[model samples]
Target chain A: MRHHKALFKFAIKAGEIMLRNGAETYRVEDTIERILRTQDLEIVESFVTPTGIFATMDEEDGETVTVVKRVRKRTIHLHKVALINHLSRQFVEGSLTLEEASQTLQEIESRKPYPPAIMIMSIGLAASFFTVVFGGSLRDFCSSLLIGIFLALLQQGFYNSRVSRFLVDLLGGSLIAVFALLFVNTGLGAQLDKIIIGSIMPLVPGVAITNAVRDTIEGDLVSGISRGVEAFFIAVSIAAGVGIVLKIWFAVNGGYIV
Target chain B: MILPMALQIISAFFATIFFSVMFNISRKELLYCGLSGGLGWSIYLISNQLGGSIVVSTFLGALAVSFLSRYLAILRKQPVTIFLISGTIPLVPGAGMYQTMYALITQDIEQAATYGSQTLQMAGVIAIAMIIISSLPKSAPEQRKAH
Candidate 1:
């Protein structure tokens, strides 16, 4: 049992590396992710139990490590923290060891979060709410909400990413817009923002975008920049939805010029 | 007037419970988490009602939760973020996201675009509120504790 927990025991060690490597968000950024990605390890009931990172994961050594996380405080060499960046700056060159640079990455990788079902549902609802709010009108709101949540759910249903996620989003937005309109013909009132807004609320990038901007303002440059990029992409996605729909509407109805 | 606000508090309460459960909160501590969130949300609503900025309201709400969690972390002997994230849900700018999105649905392109930027601002404000409220432990740049 002791041997099983030994491999992942470097968690605190990993944190030390964050400061040593001068990485942003301290590799603690991806805790849930790294634990889930281990091919050799099997975790049993690792919830945020009051016990501190509780779970029974079988280590490669055929032993169970009873993992319990606690308030980990340790002093680190602040000078070493600036050294990696200094070295890179002095070199002014691209050639660097993947090991050195990647050590920081591995630490970040370790902080990835677990995508729980309820959280996913919450995310979907939030996204739906955002779209519904923009769509306006009860019919538009409901359709957008339904579509956005459905699309987000599709991402879950297929474990989608990259290109697949993009395709699903486009399809999801289009489908929701079209269907919500169709449903409106069923005699729904004009004041349906409530339903629509609630549904699409999950789609808004508020949290991620807010976190990004806040990080930048808070002085976590790397995390702030990365989060900013993520926020930009989400914004772009929303823009694309607007552009595509507007183009279609223009072609058919001669609506206001974009 | 008060009912939806109470409903929102309830919604936030459930959200906190879900987060705590995921984190493996002790069963005995469950009510504390929910109540902390609900109470934090009520404070947020009240502050916003008093002509305080949403960001300011969120900050106050987060502060309420953070102080409580810090107390509970001592009383309950657990990490503060665990309690903080749960209790701070109601103040997370969930509603602003919809406001921006609703603005975008308009045929008025100019207005839609304006709302888009507004949406981003709200998001940034919310993040600031969250970050400001959660008192992070200081460490050297090299330290990489789990966030």
Candidate 2:
């Protein structure tokens, strides 16, 4: 009975880690089930959504346990997802003892993301390169690079603020437009539109949109709808951010510089 | 034209690499992510230059990205989402979304509607492309009940 309880806790912990790190709903459910089934449990089931996970298992002696883990935050860390996937596979293959598996999962859980300095630089470079991809000139690229750096800094500054993600994106979008306008107006950049577009690329909800579609296709309709709504709102916040700034600029300048 | 196309592809490769860093993908997989992004954007450019509409070109580009991601997932033993999300970044409708919102803010309702629907269509086609690729049957060895 104690062994079964430990097994259930371990499996649910693995699922929670996956869920918190942005694994798909079906993937989390599948991982939990695979891990639990390794012990010959009579009943094992897991239900996951974008926001929470519910799992229950039963033993042959009429001993049943259910655990519900509520996941409030999600960030894309595919490295963690891949690690947990590998761990679960090893556990299912019986190559790993339960203690070793749980210990490794603990280590994986505490793994930090890439260093902030590197992340900020990469965010800036991503925006600038995207500017070039969209046909921006060298001057525009330079301007976008600077704007991207500032946007990254802004996001980092707000990281611990507990503000809504949408608000951060909204501010990031406005900052991009403001910088683009200032650069173009001051003759530092040639294409205002290109610069704004490039810098905003970092804020786009590519992961959410893709995961939403994938979850829906995998028949996790609840996760799908919620993620789709997330993507839509993120897009809107970004647009509104840029739109408000552009509208104000146009009104002040009495012309369409966009 | 060829030079521009090559430039776009190269930029897309680097862009995707840095984007993957933001998503915290492991270091070893960064190069493959870049390769997939370059492949997707190259396909998009080629199809567009071949007279395909923007929507159709985007669909083809996403299709290529999805296929490459699945293949890389098997070869590298990583989750397919790691590649799929980063690779599709270059084809996402960020520019279109901006243009639509810009038109709307300027009170150009006609232009806004046009760009808005185009953006929606591009997003929709990308989703459909992913669904088609994911729904395809896998071979025996690589088969997993859940993807």
The model with the greatest DockQ is 2
CA shift at B6, candidate 1, in angstroms? 1.7
Once superposed on the true structure, which residue ranges of model 1 sit more than 4 Å away at CA? A1-24, A27-149, A160-179, A182-184, A187-191, A205-219, A242-258, B15-40, B53-59, B62-117, B134-147
The CA lDDT at A219 in model 1 is 60
- Each candidate's TM vs. the true structure? 0.53, 0.98
**Over 4 Å off in model 2, which ranges?**
B144-147
Candidate 2's chain A scores what TM-score?
A: 0.97
For model 2, how does the per-residue alpha-carbon lDDT over A106-200 read when each residue is reduced to its tens digit? 99999999999999999999999999999998898899889999999999999878899999999999999999999999998998888888899
* List of clashing residue pairs for candidate 2: none
State candidate 2's TM-score: 0.98
Judging by TM-score against the true structure, name the best candidate: 2
**Per-residue lDDT tens digits of candidate 1, residues B1-147?**
576666566655654554444333445676788877777877787898799876677667766776676666556544344455456544554345434544555455676576556555545555555565444653342132222
